[model samples]
Target: MNGPGKIYNTINKCRICGADSIVDLINYGEQPLANSLKKHRDDVEQKIPLTLSFCKQSNHVQLKETVNKELLFSDYIWVTGTAASTKRFAKEFAQRVIQITNLQSHELVIEVASNDGTFLVPFKELGFSNVLGVDPAENLKTAALQNGIETITAFWNKNVSEEIIKKRGRAKVVMARNVLPHVSQIFDVVEGIRCALQDDGVAIIEFHNAGTILNELHYDSVYHEHLYYFSINSICYLFEKYSLYPFHADPSPISGGGYVLYLSATRKNKSKSLLQFMEQEESNKVNSHESWNRFAERCVEHKRLSREIIDKYYGRRVIGFGASARSSTYLNYCEFNSGNIEAVIDNNPMKQGQFTPGSSIPIISMEGGLRRKPDIIFILAWNFRHEIINLCRSKGYRGDFIVSFPFEPKVIQS
Candidate 1:
């Protein structure tokens, strides 16, 4: 049960531009919460209508339905410290931010939705101890506090920003990583950012690029928590509404490929790279409704082909790899249960005894999963395909592998 009562709501108007009409790109049907894993296989899961949409007026993509924010994030299991890729990126990101902004050690820095303070530790490592982490998850806040990072257990809103400004003063550096899309109250959060940031301060916002999601066919990323899939134009519109101007943009390794945008209150000179990137978006027609319709067509085709490939190896001993949130979306979308996949291997110990939502596939430890010695290793965490493949090889599991992304979905042999 999703709490005691109703937990779903439908949004008719565009959250960004207040448009009355929007285009429905893809209907995923009823889907479970991507991160909500069940303790037992028989445990019932809540399913909600999952539909992706496009706002022609704002050129932004968002979900038609929204799950309650408290239910989705109050007590969370996903942590940034679980992945090596994220850890390495945190270090690199800190270095880049410091170099670009010349951030001083005395200046206050805050990170929104700072899971386990993975990104904040790097700033401290560079002699910047005046860092704060704000998040809604109690477990994650506790974890970040244990790491000696100051964290506030609260959702980021205009009120919270005003409180922070009153207590800690306005921040010189504010970083929001992968949190903008999850926010249903987009305007409230943007206003909070504006209130919390100094006029000259730089706010770093990193999000999954909508153009990449369309062109790459990363449909598995469409989950309830992610309310919006922002294109560069859409993000610019959102920020510019609050008098924030993006001056620079860079590529990020997160979610296959993402964008790290630097914004400030003052309209400084925009970087050449930022201009070129927006021009490329225009050239690619990334924000056009026709492109979205074509993407929907490709999604339908990818689903058919992927299911065909999965069925072809149905008779073999197939083991699933990486019980990630994205894996939940892919598995449930394909309707794969414990019958098709023996068990899912996850590095996170918290998920080891849990069953995946909707699909009911048991999650197990990496060692236990490898010991089964299956004929095929179906990698659901396709973004870390190379990393998972290397780890499996090092563990002496020489078996055939299957990857579901970059479309047409291929199988590689040992």
Candidate 2:
């Protein structure tokens, strides 16, 4: 389907195995780019196809459609430091990386998709004197540099990795956190990781666990930016193809609960926990088409329940709690119209004046949203539901706060 801006094409072959066994999992229809918030009412909204598919051969679940990299990533707005989950994860991940790899002061460490150098800040403070970040977003690069983090304003690839190799030798640790899903060149990114590391170095990659998504029914996590979902099996399959062996992985509390895969060039004994996790996926029918079909059905029911609650409070003064990318997917999928939501409250100043992508609900400050004592508050960032509700109650708001999907639709009194 052609959209208002650039048209994207759907792929027939699997991105990992190069097999023409891709099967349709679900489609979210034409959606405006998740982070494309607008400054004006008449701004041109760029809608594109958002789809999910799975490979029958490799059991890899990915998007059939591909958006232009520049259109999606250039001048990016989502920063890693914005969310508490990400901030906490960065510090913990830095320490975990040190312990896992035995990283030293002189040994170099590199991070791809290192937005605002949130992760690199700790790497610098934790004795890794040589730390570098590779990202394409100019705004984030500027912020990273201001924080005394050395960053290259480029996407990670074999060429860029070779350049890093030439400039500052092979790195001991290459940390890629929650980046594989956004990466367009699957093979190239893996090859770049392989090329960027020393023979003994370990490349740690983190991915949102497919098991969590399937079990928790996090359909909001699916959007244009995320091109693929990863399971333990899929991670192993892709790495082994490039002679990189996956030796260790843990379901870490990074990016709202994800699996961290530790890969090296040489073979090592797979941890018992990693093997057990893979077996759990098999038992859960992670690769079966029926699981995906049931997931789609569940998602539809979730949306229906949301609309039922939202439709009840028709003319009430309702404001969305978080103006996040996930909120964009939720609003768009549930068809939450502007008349129902007065404004979206956000702590991020960058989003305050802009309007949400598809919904066009104006983004306002916390003060502005709370000033009128809204009758209904819709919590869009469900992951931070506890924090949001507590904040509302602390601010003297006793009205009911609504948490977004998967959970049964009910307004909680603050």
Candidate 3:
């Protein structure tokens, strides 16, 4: 069974704009902690309550409760700069900052939630006198230090922001990439940025756009860790609240499905470009509740078709690729059990020997894919489908691949 009843709530006021005008959007029923992987001997596990709600006033999607931060951030398994494309993005972003700001060699650049210092190293190589990374993950911070990147293992809250301001002064440029959505109290995170930034400094925050997620039917992105799903309209409202401004937005296909955002705090005078984009999005009905409801329906249909397709052909030899956090929702919501999926194969050695949190499906190495030689491989980590397909090909596994999102299951010949 896919859990019990759905968790519902009523929001009279918007979290972003604080307006009394609010309406219900599509709700993704109760879900467990997506990233909570199980260890061999560790039996203790916490199943936090989770639900998704949308604010009609500002079009901001948010989780109903404030889940524990430790479960998401501390001892985090996922690193920001691990993927090849993300590393390229980090390096390119650093170069662009230097070019746009005309930063002097002595100017300082800081990044919050700078996992493993992947982005900072590029700035360091550019001969920037000061470059600092602040992240709460102690292990990752130590790893960054080992890689010759200066890092402070502390959460970037108001207190930490004040300390940094006093010791290092305001940073010339601050970057928080893919970190905003994980925050429970978004206002506090924005305040921290304001404190750490110089008067003329600009802060760039990148997040997964809510419009893309809904329109593309990216239900996998819905996890307990991600507290907010931001659209340009919602983000604009959020920025205004914190005395910050969103001057620009450049949609890109960077993070798997799509990412459409580039916000700056320096421009007090709002750009017509941003307004035009917002208006265009509104015209397209991107913020309407009806759109999300329809999209949610599509997601359900896709899940049904995928289950049917897999059941028709494979019988019992199907296995999943990518034991990712998103796979948790897919498995739990679709009522998939260990019987349907023989095992999960992952490239990360840390997770290879462990089991999935909710489903308890054993995670094995990529070698297992070859050993089992299943007829079809259900790609649970659909975001990295291209990379995974290439990897399986390199490993000499010629099985068909399955994608269970956007539309019901479809097989891609490799």
Candidate 4:
């Protein structure tokens, strides 16, 4: 049900439950595609409605409007290897899976949305011959292949899963990191997992936690690309339908504290730790309408505070650090264009010389931008606050370095 020129799609029913009963959350209004970097200054940015909604039946949180996959993928440039923290996490994550699952080299491990084959590369290094990566990004797939990572350049769906099973047999483990929300058909993804995995197989998925997003008022996390936000409740309800059960789960600090869930075809027993985590969520008011309403009020105030801070340093050369996807949402929401942000400094060369999707802020090399001696360095990629702040201080940029997250902008002392 798609065409080449299709711009977007709308979901009236709940993404997880397939129910007509749903509740409207906050509307961030029309937003440009977050990862749609501007190659030409004259190219027009595509805009779409960025509204969030919650389901009464399933307690799932998701975006009402979904940006087409073609716009975000195809020639995707966001690489996992580009981020230092993620690179470290990928190695550790691969090792952890090996230790817990006791995965043998002969058993296949398939990673969906494996950007630049970052995680799979570690598996290959560890002597895992049966490792494969599936992604829709052509440029990234090419890079992975050149680097000796075997990859299937396609989106992971039931058809793709069947194709993989026919070629390589069922996977012992299927992995998707920080990619669940970006998927439009939530059920298709989980169903594909069911089809692709062996009887004793496991599926590890990590997604942005709705509780953290609501409690911390991280409104900037919302964008057109992020189709669905998840909580433990939402994840369980969605997976259980396809006979996949979450036997274990933990919290992740990246992406504003995500939930790392380990699911399998068979549940050996009800995990006590998992039960306790669910209890914690219930006490945290994850399902209550009041909790989200409170979050909505805070989002309004946070936006006001961020604008005031930008206005305070009016006429000062304010360049942003970390031209990340998260930064795109925040910059656009706050209306920080070239007039406000001098230029965004990024470590990734792929992003350099390109403009941010909405703000149209030019992405430049970190060293080049720091040498310009901007008065204030606003850290949009606040997740790498420590690393970025240290880099700036080491370069002798005697200016205010601000971190925005967990609260308003706080100036990090030198």
Clash statistics: count for each candidate:
0, 0, 1, 0
Candidate closer to the true structure by lDDT (higher is better), 1 or 3: 1
Per-residue lDDT for 183-208 in model 3, tens only?
86678888888788777777777777
TM-score of each: 0.97, 0.95, 0.89, 0.95
**lDDT of candidate 1?**
0.89
TM-score of 3: 0.89
Q: Per-candidate RMSD vs. true structure?
A: 1.7, 2.0, 3.9, 1.9
Error of 2 at 99 (Å): 0.5
Best by lDDT: 1
**Poorly placed runs, candidate 2 (over 4 Å):** 1-6, 406-409
Q: Please say which candidate is ahead in lDDT: 1 or 2.
A: 1
lDDT of 2: 0.85
Q: Candidate 1: misplaced stretches above 4 Å?
A: 1-5
**TM-score preference between candidates 1 and 4, better one:** 1
Q: Cα deviation in Å at residue 64, candidate 3?
A: 1.4
Q: Distance from true position, residue 147, model 1, in Å?
A: 2.0
